[model samples]
Target: MNTNDLKIFEAVVESGSFTKAADIMFTVQSNVTARIKSLEEEFNAKLFSRTSRKVELTEEGKILMNYAKQIQHLVEEAKNEIISNETVNGHLTIGCMETTMTLKAPEILLAFGEKYPAVELEFKSDNRDSLISAVLNYKLDAAFVSGPLNISGLEKIKIKEEQLVILASSKEAGLNKLLAKEPMKSIVFDNGCIFRERLESWFSHKGIHNYKSIELNSIEGIINFVDAGLGISLLPEEVVSRYYQGRNICTYSLNKQLGTMTTLLVYRKGKAPSTALQSFIDMHIEDIA
Candidate 1:
């Protein structure tokens, strides 16, 4: 029930280790354990299932974790909002898609941090769906995500519009000829990926059905697999060109209807951003998380 207990709980959940969470808080492991025990006693529910390797959340723990995260974020938001605008402070947690994190977020973080030196910033990166879910649940103050976002109760500010491109190996035939040769196999992220739906739509449009798809978690893996002639994938032109530079990969532009995606800075619709978060949006640099 206490904010401090929830904060400690959040740290433990994030670290997955009482000792490490204690280290982060500059406290002893026993103190961390005591705080967790206090929380469990106060709520009359077990929060974590402990094992030798790591602590896992129980069903009740998972439910409480959501509320704990939302409370922790709100506490931070309130602290930041109550501070003088002339001097911004408090922690800001933002979510971002992997593409934006890699290609755009660095400069934005640097500039924002320089402007509000007292503010602490933490970023979590994942697929668009995950980012959206985190933001919706108040796990993040805001996030940089790609569309199409159909979720409710979100306000989006379009930051970047990227054209999706298909990368083809230089040794292989062009897109048409390549598709003709085999049932398409793509190296992509799992179902919640930003580009998965678009990529599937593109295939369906081309009358290519029942193709083989493989999931990969790394940007390098996706690009390398395609470059090695494993399969084709749809990705942001700007990102692929930047990361896969000096390679023998050639980009094939898709139809405008299928190839364009927009990166958005989305937050809850009714809530106002903290000064620290506002600075990030106002900086409005061309790219990054």
Candidate 2:
């Protein structure tokens, strides 16, 4: 009947079980069950069908879920609008790709934090796909991505263009030439990484599809793995240049045919940017341009 009920419903759907949702929401399982029951009663329809295995959404629940999403979005917008007028003070959640978190983002964030110390900044670093989803779900105010992005319902502002390079340990000489000898082994972030996806697509396009992947979750892990001669990876030139100096990594530019992926500052369309967030983005735009 209220925002809390909508949040409970959304959490339950995402977590896939009432008990799990309760744990996430920091409430008892019965409380989660009661909230869902209250919501279903309010709609005069069943929202979920529970089985021994898992909970599934009923057809009516599907419809309500969509409405609930809109309701939650509007409520948050209202709250932000009210709080934004008081001062440029509130929580700002940003989604970042691992590469950006290393160097470029820090300078901009440092300046922003100093300028608006009242604004609390929270960052979530993950793969590109999840960042896009976070923006779509209103979980992040904005995100920085390496692209050409395929995200819908968002505005993509070109921040800068970064060259993508194939990198290996400095000790491995002539490995770039050896890429043709066999499908290269790669140390990759997960499937959601834009660079990882781009590299795979490039390989598939060139009829080189037999590479092996070592999956890791962080940029530090990738750099360390590549430093140990585990495999090669593709990253923005700026990111690697700042972080990999004297770290036993050698880099070579990808072919000109692959071009460069422009780095973008992305946010959902039709939403107003807060003063602090706008100022931060404007600073980046000014500094870059």
Relative to the unseen true structure, what is the C-alpha lDDT of residue 42 in candidate 1, on a scale of 0 to 100?
84
Task: Tell me the deviation in Å of residue 260 in model 2.
Answer: 0.8
Model 2, 248-267: lDDT tens digits are 99888777656487878898
Please give the CA lDDT of all the candidate structures. 0.82, 0.81
Most accurate candidate by TM-score: 2
The number of clashing residue pairs in each candidate reads 3, 0
Model 1 Cα lDDT, one tens digit per residue, 1-289: 5787787888898899999999888899998999999989988999899999999899989999887876777777776677756687877788987777788679767877787789788888888888888888877878988866766789888887899987777778687888886678877888888777788988899899968998988778888888888888888999767778777688888898888888788887766777777776676644444
Q: What is the lDDT of residue 123 in candidate 2?
A: 80
Which pairs clash in the backbone of model 2?
none
- What lDDT, from 0 to 1, does candidate 2 have? 0.81
